[model samples]
Target chain A: MLPELLQGVDTGGLLVIQDSASYSGRHLLQSFINAALNREEAVHVLGFEVSEEELKDGLRGSPVQRLHFHNAYTDPLGWTDHPAFTVHQFCLGELTRLVKQTSHSKPATLVIDSLSWILRHVSTPDVCRTLQQLRKGGAVRSIIGLLHADMHQRGTVGSVCHSATSVITVEPAMRGDEAVAKITKRSKSGKVIQDEEIFRIKDDLTVVVQSKSSKGAKKADSEEQETDPTANLTFNLRLSDTEREAKQKLALPFVFSKEKKTALLHSGPGSGRIHYEPDANDDYDQEDPDDDLDV
Target chain B: MYTELNSILNTTPDSFTQGEFVLLSDRQSDASFLIHHFLSLYLRARCKVCFVGLVQSFNHYSAISQRLGVSLTQAKEKGQLVFLEGQKESLSVLIPQENDTGSQAMDFLRDPSVGLKNLYEFVRSAVSSNGEEGGDGSEEWGPPVLLVDDLSVLLSLGVSAGAVLDFSHYCRAIVCSQLQGNVVMLVRCDGEGEEDEGDDEGSERLMKGLTHQCSLTLHVQGLPTGYCRDIHGQVEVCWRRRQGDGQYTQKKLFQYKVHDKGASFFAPGTSSAVL
Candidate 1:
């Protein structure tokens, strides 16, 4: 719906995520690109900060030519490193230059995995200004990312939100020992208050399908293997089956501090299932034998 | 403004692969500054600069002609500057005896013999001649105009205000007749203040008259509260409109600026809508 909401805009729109930690921004961007890019020459994905080895391992068996790939760690000489040192560093001249280059390249889609890191490296005002420059320069059609911050007041979020066409906010909700994801759209006043949905993290990074009737069936998977040639639904091919999984995996280590258990999940191209393990923390206190001895 | 023009001209390559147009608008004084700046750059680039100033007074008219490096008689004869005043009382009484003698020597028709007819004839011939020459002579520069001040002053005195509008129509016609390049017209009026004194009927009449012309109008409203809240508070923007086909379109020939570099626009937050 975020892409549908941004249907008619000419220049690419902005998406700012303020949260400094958690890689939701990256996941959102991957999903947006996967949904938007289709034609052979229409889309280009330039990945910054990650290693070539990591990218190859992750994208194995996937079509890589459709994306104009870059790995900052691997291609250090040509790539612009993630300069998240300070607020000024994020809005560095280097960033502006990169925006100009990307615009000239003329891709239908542009993805900045995490806007939060840019904010961490630069002041809000500067970030806002840099976004204006990118918008004017004619970058891709939509720029989606994760925004993170320790605390974000309504007013602060509203101001930055003005630059964007649509915003979807995600949060972690607890249901017993498992972590559920809740998603909401931003209201007119910039508050995340509409169409709330709780989802379970099933397959590696698969998106939590919101509709109840379609909960069990993977939309892309169902559409891809439709036995009925005259199915009632008109399937959109752009949205891929592995897109949701790729989005989640892109935002690695999706951790929530309040949750008692932390899940570190990893999966590969041919792997049957991803492995999820609980991370231990100091919050759990051991029971003393003298205090409560039952044996 | 001239400094900016000079910088733009110098920095931008003379031969650009993409099309470019220098769109400009400003207040009266600022407009003058801008034209001067543009002319200097045009001259340096081997382009031409043309001026079209309308005058209603003899003394001020002569001064303007002098500043433009042209004599009063030549300006009238060449049809570059139009004298809107009529009759002997229209400053003919003060045409110094020495100038009269000099005018005759220079082949300028007698001031007393000249009427609006002479003015019309000169303009028609000048426009036609530009058309005949193919208008793109190596020495010929881009058509730049400076409408000195408002021509409405003449109409507001005794004639109907419609006369002022008529003058604007005529000016537009002349420019269109020999469209070589861009033309910048400067008009001064009571602006928003005069709108109230005219009453509803009069304002409606003016609006009706204006509706005939196809023009892009930008309303620059000032928000006093934001004057110092950030930096630039005064905002200027071209009003966008939808076409007959129901597609959103932007006016191609306009640009805007906020009063401060740090501010957005001046309109109240509520009345403004975001896309």
Candidate 2:
């Protein structure tokens, strides 16, 4: 998982950054498209390095078809000659157009790869607000944005996170040579509107999926030879002879003097607020609607 | 097997009976092919069955029918035959006019009167004319089945999701109203990408209306990253009452499959029998 730390963050859109060589990234991209089409097709997004042959070979025996959106950084040969606009512009235009055209009655699913780049070109805030509007507009069958994890440090990622319906984090966990697949939920706050709640309840918990490996296995050998709880005639217990030595050490003082208090006042509210619990509801109930205003 | 299909299709054992209509959609090639094959075989002698490819030639239909050694003419005569390609086009796209197809175009679907009558007539003529010639005319089309090759085509072509869902809901309403025939809408979501927040929203909207419109609604998802190639799915059924609180109750149907075979509660694996 290139964005390992982004285990539970849904910055609305996705940010996918992988080693490029790992086919996992490619598979992940394909999964997004597949999810959008309701898994009717094995459609996957074309990456900067993806090839037609690879797509065909990988999607062998799958029903999904590819709908390639234009890319500017790549495919320059076809960029200027084929269409009047660039690839990114075309993709966003098509996406936005799709959102505008779709109906609210039926469901639509939209899957886009790399929101980070999309935002870099268009302002992040615009993308955020546009997504919100599109969702409300009901023109989208569905909308899913993919982003790389590293982009979270950027200010825009935080803004996007606050607006998403749900967020899912996929990452790799390794202990020695063994690997564990961990799926973390970031979109728990998103409302459940379908049959997914049943599946989540029955199957969402992490299972102890054991791999066929024993190199790093640790065995527990403690056994108390009691066959039946009440039938036991005798019991043997081991008592360890432990020794204690008296020792004296200076105790650290937790309290600060007046000088420290003065420094704390100057330090800031963060430290000062930690020392007390203010009544948040104190004036909330007592406030009168007729109270005078500065206006 | 043919007996069961005949019974479900609501056709008399001896009299020529038309097949029921079913719609199956998904992008899993193997799944789409399997569904097509199963429906074709089941509806073979009793009904005409053909899997239409989006990019593949319509002639492929004839070829498939020939290879199966099932007489397409016989199927057509019985009003139990149908084939559809996966191409996405406008409502006005020119549908080829053939003697067999009287008015199955978009206009006909919207109005349904002339087209449905014409369809019934075509079936009657096909069955009465050819079914009498052979001793096998009494054979029922395997089962009435409609297969939608890919549902995403409707979505990608900019078809209103609401419209597609409405059609599905409409089919269910009609089926329930008739109470004799069954309509199955097959939607295949292959992997992780198949599940979208938007689909959930749409499903919620459908559910709001489904209380009175449908007897059952099943959702399935395929998993590519597990010990089991396909994850076991759950089917939730909700029903509405004519009186009382009209509150809905949900029950999960276990052991559903989500994979290349396409997800459905109507059929399990290659078996035509619904369990």
Candidate 3:
């Protein structure tokens, strides 16, 4: 999924990787490196968050001969050496110079391993300015900046996003070990397009784009179905009193006649039936007002 | 004619009253939605807005406003909106030492007090200019609203806590007291990438000071449930308002689903939504 997406990234455009705490962006970076190598393009890595050894090991098996590294990480001894270039951690000038010199000759893909380090030393605007300069300078054909989205303020992230032509956000999925990579922002030929896709990493380090028709998709579909006007329709049977009586009569002949006579007698007070019974409860009700006056 | 957020504000008797300072705090994930939600409401109400953008570029804000169905271009043309670029100014401070354009960059970089003063002056000028030229004559023009996007960025740029606090006080004084306008400021609460211990302390102090001064504080936080179904994240808003009698009223937690367009408050079991 990422390789295909990387293929879509136009030359001389800026791509931002919004890395989360899960390190899901590492895979995307690897995929980008692989894609660039496959295209026979030179890959220049500006390592700040990771060590040079780690970068070499990560891309060891890849068939890329023109791999260059500019190490910016300082060790505990406060001494570092790289074949390409080494500078103090917070010196933006040296870093900018290195980036410019590397992409000066040919169209190379410049990858900054992480931007959080730079952000720590300089403001987001400075970082954005540097990136804008790089793009405007036309030195690097493609600039990929990796940023840990969880670590920075929203404004910082927004500034970085504002500076980028494309933004890919990688987040962890709710379900087991899978991560979701989304093309949250993509600018193609001066037009911005937004797309989100769920993906999972495999054992072979290849990204498998999960279909949207997964469990969550089905749940959303069901929700849509629920909102349909016809979904709430329910069928119920109704019976009137006469119909119920008729049904009862059909079920039992003698029992129905007795019930019918009782129903007719109780239907009205003037049903032409004579009654001479004494009112037993009425006599008690009349005496209760005086009998209970002891209170 | 107001948006859903205005309607929500209408629920409270004194919510969103004139001359009030509103502070919105959220994590990095849900900040944009909250900011956009309120900004859209203000814009739709046809209020004059001076947006000091420190976190996002003007283009980014414009794109977001367009996506959310707010006419940013029209607002700007009518002098109903003005965007003051804080990101560029804040970043110019960090330009390499040798290449520094001495006078201008040095003005902002020499001291945090100067940056805050510059910001105050910029906002005052923007609001006054927009108020004078408010083009629509159908309705009476009220005081122009002032919005500061993300105060934490200033602190991250080595601004002192005292300077940030002073800046907030000045903004509130200008918008709430002097101009009788509304001031909405955004501050990020979570300290994610702040490596320095002193920086964290400064940010906390700034937040506390702002909270003490602001009339209303909306705290937006992402739920731990992660993403479920169509819900990218769950946000719980705790709105705290300061009353006239020097007491604070705590509102119920408003739960919402953070979606692509914006955040929509959840009904008990139904999904009536908002952007």
Per TM-score, the best of the predicted structures is 3
lDDT by residue for model 2 (B28-142), tens: 2223333434444545335323332333444555555455455555555555654444433212334543543433323324343322233223222332332234675454433
Instruction: List candidate 2 segments past 4 Å from native.
Output: A1-234, A237-295, B1-30, B45-57, B65-74, B84-104, B107-143, B175-179, B198-275
Docking class of 2: incorrect
lDDT of 1 by residue, A52-164 (tens): 34334333344445555433222222112342222233333654444444443554554553454344334567767866766665544545544543323345466667776
Candidates' lDDT values, in order?
0.37, 0.37, 0.64
Which has the greatest lDDT? 3
Relative to the unseen true structure, what is the C-alpha lDDT of residue A295 in candidate 3, on a scale of 0 to 100? 71
Q: Ten consecutive residues with minimal summed lDDT in candidate 3 chain A?
A: A74-83
- The deviation in Å at residue B132 for candidate 3 is 2.8
Q: Compared with the true structure, what per-residue lDDT tens digits does model 2 show for residues A1-295?
A: 2123222223333332221110123344443443333434212242322234333344444444433332322331131235322324524455556434433433444545445445544677677766676556544434555554332334765677556654443333333212223332343455432211100110111122343222223222123333454574476453333411221233336757686779766876555444556674544544575444465
Backbone clashes (count) for model 1: 18
Pick out the ten consecutive residues of candidate 3 chain B with the lowest summed lDDT: B239-248
Model 3, position B22, has a per-residue lDDT of: 80
| Candidate 1: residue B210 Cα off by (Å) | 64
DockQ of 3: 0.01
